[model samples]
Target: MSTILVTGGTGTLGRLVTERLRAGGHEVRVLSRHAQPYAVDLRAGGPGLDAAVAGVDTIVHCASAPRGDEQAAAHLVAAARKAGVPHLLYISIVGVDAVPLGYYRSKLAVEKLVGESGLGWTIVRATQFHDLVVRLLDGLSKVPVLLLPAGVSDQPVEVSEVADRLVELAVGAPAGRVEDMGGPEVRTFPSLARAYLRATGKRRPLVGVRLAGKAYRGMRAGGHLTPEHAVGKGTFEEYLARRF
Candidate 1:
């Protein structure tokens, strides 16, 4: 069996990836800050990173934060190069190039670093996860009125579907910048918020406000959506029904 090291193995996507890999009878190592023995913070770059990446066949990089993602990717790349890791697969958002947000820019930078790292690499850009959309609605539901951005739409995919795809890519040979993964449907924020309210049995008025920003404009223009690549099976309504 091949040995696979999953960075951010304890996270939402990483945990699922680790489980799937282990279930397939592969030797899986979970590398996270709290994971014993391989507890290395990628953003800080340490000796533990070198140890974690050594002799692994593939690395499913799912660790990410709002900030410092570029630093984390650089450290991980350096460690992977030193360990002679053959394959490095990264998970990125769909609109990193189109969106003008700071986090999206960081993700795009990481993508470039991986592509030019002189190692066999693959990058999969998927739409936002259903969980993130739920979290956004949750935060906006704190009051009687739910404020959402006008004209902004998202194709939220299932996290498990993304993890499954990542596992498949991890086992296969590196194919740079493969087909994008998108959800089954493109939905507006207000519509999704309504779905959440219906599933949770909460009553709230959704108000869509027009925002002036490049990022908002990008989102409104459907930069974050991939209608042609709607390969994911799960729907947001299904997720809401199951979750609630």
Candidate 2:
């Protein structure tokens, strides 16, 4: 079995990937800011990383900062190269190029760094996760009413499915910019929120407000969902049924 190093091993997606890798009989190591049994922060250079990458064959980069921070990607790439890791896999979001959001921009910048690093790499851009749907609803519920920023369509995929795909990518050869992975169906913000509310048995009023900008308009025009690559098996309704 190969030794795989996962960045952000404690996160929602990273944890699942680590579990799957372990289940498949691979030696798993995690990179975190805090010192764990097999942890090293990429931002802090030197032997800490050397110890982490000592015998690892693959590096799955799942760590990310807030939406606007582009420098983190450069740091990660530099560390991986310095460590002489053979294979690198980067997890990114879908619609990063189509949408003009700060997070998407940051992701795109990272993609560039990975490409130029001269490392054998694969970049998998996935849709918003099922957990993100719940987070969005919770955020809206905090306010008296749920206000959607006028436009934006999302095809949220199950986190488990995304994790599975990442694992597959990790095991296989480098496929630069692989096909986009998304949920089974395309949905609007208001509709998704209402469905989520109904699933959770929460009685919250949802209000859709149009914002004056091309970014907002792009969302409303269904810019986020990928019609050609809707490969995920879990539907929004299926996800809710399992949870609620």
TM-score of each: 0.99, 0.92
The residue ranges of model 2 lying beyond 4 angstroms of the native Cα positions read 67-69
What is the Cα-based TM-score of model 2?
A: 0.92
Give the per-residue Cα lDDT of candidate 2 at 161.
Answer: 94
Predicted candidate 1 versus true structure: per-residue lDDT over 1-244, tens digit per residue: 8999999999999999999999999999999989988998899998889888989999999999988899999999999999889999999999999989999999999999999999999999999999999998888899999899998889999999999999999999999999999999999888898899999999998898999989999999999899999999999999998999
List per-prediction Cα lDDT, in the order shown: 0.94, 0.82
Judged by lDDT, which candidate is best?
1
Each candidate's root-mean-square deviation in Å?
0.7, 1.9
lDDT of 2 at 188: 80
Q: Which candidate is the best by TM-score?
A: 1
- How far residue 110's Cα lies from its native spot in candidate 1, in Å, is 0.1
**10 residues in a row with least lDDT, candidate 2:** 67-76
| Cα lDDT for residue 16, candidate 1 | 99
Return the lDDT, model 1, position 122: 99
